[model samples]
Target chain A: MAQKPLQFRLNGAEKAVFVEDGANLLDVLRRSVGDLTAKRGCAQGGCGACTVLIDGVPGLSCLTLAETVEGRSVATAGGLPGDGSHPLQEAFMAHFAAQCGFCTPGMLMAATALLESTPHPDRDQVVHALSGNICRCTGYEPIIAAVLEVAGEGGGGRS
Target chain B: MTIHRGRGFASINYPIGMNLGGDPSQALVHSSPDGKFAIALSSIDLGQGMKSVTRQIAAETLGVPVEDVYVDTADSDTGPHCMGSFASRGTHRVGNAVIVAAKEARAIMLEAAAEELEVNADDLETDGRGNIHLRGAPDRSITTGDACQAAQFRHGKTVAGRGIFLIPLSEVEPETGEMTPVSCYAHAALVADVMVDDETGEVTVEQVNSAYEVGRAINPRLVEQQLVGGAWMGLSHALYETTEPRYPDRSHGPVDFSQYTMPGPGDIARHDIAILERPAPDGPFGGKGPGEMCANPIMPAIANAVFNAVGVRVTALPITPEKVLRGLKANGGARPGPRR
Candidate 1:
């Protein structure tokens, strides 16, 4: 397979990479681009650990072919503002939304897309939006609370 | 068009650490020349916040800020030996070892500071801001980094400490098969409320309330996460997960998460947890770990609830719809079978 120069905007920088056809954007970002934030959990779309923002939309990077991302903007957990400045990141830490942090990147990315789309989403909407991401730790309560907190909803409306 | 409601209860307990007598975790604490420190241990974090908890313990003992301490859990060959992370002993076992090591290192740091300040080692105290000063005198102090330089160059002493936590062997009485297997045990009780649809043979757990005695929570948030995650795991085990569904036939076994079912966000129940603090006398900082105890009681509780709802007993793991329907058909959902 011939490799092609796949160029895309990552975080805030424009980057170009040589990727073979059928290579996944996850591998290109992690191996070729040296960004290890996006975890390689399950590799299959089932885990959703490789979720990333493609044009501000959450997509499973593992299932995405590298060539398809050419000229598209991609965002990841590392792209979030440093020092826990992002509302989601601060909310995550404040609410103890992360444990092990293996799934944090994907969860954060998924939540980022959710918050962008539905700023005042209800508990069910948050759950539905985060259905694709799986976290073995923190059970999803704190994660849900963090998202809701960032939404200024005083946490999820769970009784 | 009928939904049967039921409730069930279960109580369980789990040992804190490995039962083996030689289950030991070792830690090595060393100070950097810049007054920062690192703890070398063989215990892997496994995303359970082992690194953070152990770091807090080390910093507390060393009288340093938490930010000044770093934990390196990589390379078991280079780091001290740990009995792996599965035994739920990472926090209790490794934390004790870190306390011992940090205490030793703190003594060395104080001695070095005393040398530079020309003060008695016993009279010096650490202010936790990388500074050492005499009691009742905040104005006169020396930086820990400066003391480290003096210790190495002037006193020719190294600032390091080593520690290990080991449990004594409990001899088993052959007749009764009884032994003190672990130093302490964490206890939990769970109540599961469910609704069963007789027509579809489906079970939906509406809510779960649990009480856990974790001895002590080094980090309350981390404990809650473990409890919540563990309950989810137990729910999956009781209602969804199975290695060999068609038992004795390996052809239809699930090979992946997609094939093997687990409850997603939509299926999760409302979980309410009540933490009971009963300090363990022998535990580190009066803390008995809660790693594995959270998942112990969920299965039996859910199974009991299913039986109460439909008056059918499921004796096997994962009370799947097929099993529920089979149980219902066998007894016609008239009377509950003998409880397991």
Candidate 2:
């Protein structure tokens, strides 16, 4: 294990941060990287609270070693269209699905990724793709509706 | 949404089978006997909006505005073993206890109201707005405010309620698979039409139509939302979620959320949700449990739909691509069932 300087873009801005060896991107992003939207839920990648994007693809920051993603493009839930005002976010609020708000980030990222691959993803596709993220509230209806709305608009995965 | 009212009371019922976690003395919280406020916060919001449901239950029962009904679940000290928010039992069971407690507290409030109006408690009834009025004279009603004032100042009185009631749920029989305990029960049917690639076992859930029998929908809007959420879980669990390692390990069950997939936004189908309320005999506000049952049958419904479309039945938790391919290979490519 070795310490090194890691350079990457957070929320679309270039930044340099020091990374300790064997540190998951989650720890570095929150503590060293100074971005707290990537919350520490289960921390072992079991919970999707810490999900961030690597190269526009949804990846669990908790499992990605900080050094491995150095000099690469990294994004978080903050980078998503709305600062909590995106269509997805709006849908979440309207449907009351983001009850606890803990799992929303992970859910958003995963949904963002799904829309990337398929614009008007149907219900089965949405359900299959988001199966990785866990929510304890509002079940999944509203989330499904939001994604479908975005997909229908051909907004599949971007701001 | 058709609310099938039952005599006495109603419950939102379902057999509990979700895999929930508990960190020792956490998750499950309760109140004490000495406390004046008899309350229970939903242990498992289960994304069902139960925090608000519990508050409403207590408020309605106590004949007070929801605000006056203090449903506190601050910390471990203020509560007893509160099962995590997973099942759709929040309003039914916790609300039942709260209702009983609130009813007791309301009785106390009514007693004072009776003394003030110079009428017997039997001659008084609480208006839905929490005002106690004599049966003959609706205009001569005492607000809960006045009653409380009389109890505290004029009568120098005190009253409180406390209790915890866990839904008596029974497990499905190992041999027959017949579920018992039957605390609260809800049945739902979901129809999912999916698009699967012959190359990959991956599936795209197209449209979904769900029907549930919630004993009661205290909040009709919330029930629909929670059902949609549950449908997502059921769909995801049937198609993707697994507790086994990508490799294999008995010591540690699947690592957590990372290794599994739950239904996400893209995964949602065109939804047609219908709430059928068969009010249980004991649910709060004539409402039975509809939360988890919405998720329970989704997998089977989806699986059945997939079978109907492509002609295969992948029975494991998630009807994954690999399994779909296997089933497809076993047959031809697609079997016919029903389309969503």
lDDT of 2 by residue, A1-71 (tens): 66788898888799897778798898998888677777778777666677777987888888888888877
Give residue B68's error in model 1 in angstroms: 1.9
**Tens digit of lDDT per residue, candidate 2, span B1-340?**
1111111111223553232331111122121222223354435453456667887776676666665555556554456565655455566666666666666667777888899898898888876665779998998788877787778777877655554655444566899988545455666655566666665666777777666777778888777776776666666777777775544466566665545554444445566788887777876777866656766666666666666556676667567778877887899665554433
Top candidate when judged by DockQ against the true structure: 1
Q: TM-score for chain A of every candidate model?
A: 0.93, 0.90
Best by TM-score: 1
Comparing only chain B with the true structure, the TM-scores of all models are 0.94, 0.76
The residue-by-residue lDDT of candidate 1 on B1-340, one tens digit each, is 4688888899987888877656788999998888888999989987788998999898888888889999999989899898888868888889899988998888998899988888898998888777889888877788878877777788888788999988867889999999887888889999999988887888999999999998888888888888998898788788888877465578879888777775567778889999998988877787888888788799999999988888988899889888888888898663533343
Candidates in order, TM-scores: namely: 0.91, 0.68
Query: In candidate 1, what are the lDDT values of residues A10-98, reduced to their tens digit?
Result: 99899998998899989999999998889988888887789999998999999999998889999998798778788888889988888
lDDT of model 1, residue B318: 86
**Model 2 error, position B33 (Å):** 19
